[model samples]
Target: MESKDLVSDDGRITYRSGVAARLAGLSPETLRVWERRYNLSNVERSARGQRLYSAEQVRRLSLLKQLVDQGHAIGVLAPMSVDRLQELAGAAAGRPKAAGPLKVGVVGANLARRIAASNRDGSDLVVQHSWSHLDQVALTSPLADVEVLVIELSELHDSALPLILSAARACDGAAVVVLYRFCASATIRALRAHACLAARVPADVGELLSLCRSALAGDRLPPAPPLPTSDLRFDEDALFNIMASGSGLACECPKHLADLLLMVGSFERYSAQCASRNEDDAQLHNELGRAAGQARVILEAAMERLARADGLPLPPGLIK
Candidate 1:
């Protein structure tokens, strides 16, 4: 076919028989044979009599080839529309599904409430819990076997990756989607390395869903890390319940513990990030992290003692 014959008279794009066959994973001889024998493909001919196929024709031909390869007879499938062929192929493959609502724990700008309200029907995605700030997340446990965690923020830096990672670690290694207003490509790559995906927002529900699907389908979730000994002593729900229960108290004990928890938690996170980010000062940051972890252990002891004395109810894991 001549170069000029690749397009048709209607100003629509088209491909010659050879290109079309290659694109549809068929040989020109097979395409011609099918056209001659079964009228499987409709092709326009240039004035020079070279066959031309439109993109739609190519697409249909591709689907026909797919269904045929899947053991369907070409005679029966060639009559099916693109949508029906798609449905058939999907059913044959069991359709890609995340299955059930993708429960998400969130930290950023009341995102949990927003996502929860959007998914009141519970068919797709659900909010496990929403924390307005990462500080709230750092001080308490919020992950509840969620499959995804959405972190919304204005900007993301390398320093922030450890915090985000820590939250993911705490979430049983839920896939992470970081929606930000500004993020560098390098940081996005770094996020990807840690099995976190990043996108700039104002992403709507559809875009967010797409990113979430990619995060899930990519098998990007890291294995859930082992919980620290301190974590084994108290689960998130217990900490959250205790903190809420103590809000009514005038003792100021929980307040003090909350502050300590936040400080040490932040420092432990900071030190760990520092160690990872700085090779020159690795010893210093690792030492800082260990010291901070010890401080957190002491605080946890105080919290457990306080919770028991205040008659706070613990989650089933801690009840015994």
Candidate 2:
């Protein structure tokens, strides 16, 4: 079987033998012999009992023929698993399926091809000379339901980070993963804080492929859009009245920002609860720093200014 023999008609695979033979550069008789001797393909039979091969089967057989030409024994190769064989074939031919182990897009088609070769599957792939290609597909292709954004990401200046963040923010179901050669702790923190993901991986295609695969498999869904002002504005009487009675202030902030603050406050509450357990100077200092830093940042600019005006500049060095 050869790739060209399988025609897609109304989303169904229709096969033709003469065409397969012409594309494979072998006689139809040889294909039949391989099928009968090796049980190689899951060939379908038409209403008249003529043999037909699905697109996958055709692609596999084409690789098998090439491997045979390269002096690999068919009998020895036949025992290997289909996936392993396809991996080898995809490597050799550079025509990986879009929905493979990982989906990737690179700035250049050659880069995408190279990455695809190392990664070994293409569930959904698009190659572009620039970011505009990705933007176009994302705008128009229904199949471009991306979950992870993988890029070589070198030569990206500092100015691009905020733009990248905005794109990731717009990808409702996607998690952006940058494959960069050089990274620092500051970069990592910025990425996480902005809800983007990134990793430092090898320049080799294989590592890039593996990173993308792992990222897509574990990527989180994008957070929902912020509610409208009316929806987000809460009636404090319902939830905060009780807190006020307990000596807590009623706070108002964006929902997401509030959640971030509460995460920071949780650590403070934990430290306060455990003040008796770990009485070391470093432990108390660490907890206090984290709590104060979170509290100040969580406040609106006006409130923060007011607090500073009131002489709450915080201790010299802290998480803030």
Candidate 3:
């Protein structure tokens, strides 16, 4: 594991963990921490089960480490696309970029400050203007170049609708989000009638940012991925019973399939946890987790089909 070894598997060149860390200007331990915390990708493993990083992954780590060295947080960068990370690194080096993060204007003072601080080490969305209240924002204000406007309210009612519409007009139709702690369903429906969006106060600043991104993307965002099941189809006792019943069979395939399903299902749960830990990486981790979940389901179905063919009785809960 400590050797500076190079490997090529499946025709994709790879580097040993140590070699990758060194090339990326990172210590081996830091790389391990990032891997364990972020679950960056489905990392490849050597024949001995030692970790190996693909060439592209090493290059990405080098970019990430460079940015981290310049004071960026690994948590924020871990969930970003390579192009986004490259853009951040180039900007840090005083190099120009094609474009920047989505510009967002917060109409609430407290929310603005919180978003700006949260995004200080992140990419994708930026806090542009922070007006203390909706009344303070107008047509003559810094409305230009503000792609989205986020307004926060403690309570929302019918009367406030006019002023909110006025603020939206002032921004020249920039997509608006009204985050309120209290609101009626009818009021939310009315707001949406005018091409406006409304939601209750987000549980956290990260949720707020995700809302902004999704609002702007609108129909472009893909449907939400399915979460892995907290309760697996087969319990330990059931799986053990199945294995015991398969003892007289020609092979131990049933036990092996069950073991593989358990491992894959666990990874599915872990990937979902990683997605929740950081919004930046949520999309990537969600996709990975969903894929694993789908695979687990397929494996379970195959085991059931084969078991039935071999005259094995599945647990009651597992039957269709």
The digit string of per-residue lDDT tens for model 1 on 1-320 reads 34533545668999888888888998888888888878865678878797888899898888777766643556657677888987766765663557656777778764554465456475667777778876566565646577788888654566688788778877776778888654556777778667676776543465676767656544221112322434635543455455555554677777567555745665566566656766887777677777777778888778777776777765575566
Model 3 CA lDDT for position 4? 62
Off by over 4 Å in 2: 1-100, 107-110, 117-144, 219-320
| Candidate 1 vs candidate 2, lDDT winner | 1
Worst 10 residues of 1 by lDDT: 218-227
- Residue 51 accuracy (lDDT) in model 2: 76
Best by lDDT: 3
Q: Which residues of candidate 3, in runs, are more than 4 Å off?
A: 1-100, 120-122, 219-320
lDDT for model 2, on a 0 to 1 scale?
0.48
Clashing pairs in 3: none
* Higher-lDDT candidate of 2 and 3: 3
RMSD of each: 17.7, 22.7, 20.6
The TM-score of candidate 1 is 0.40
1-320: candidate 3 lDDT, tens digit per residue: 36665657557778888889999998989988999999875778878897888878888999988866543456668999889988877765663222557787778646765565557576756776778878777745547777778898745666678888888777777778888755656777677666566777665577776666545543110324567575466654455566556555778888788667755765676667667765887888789888888898788788778777777768887667
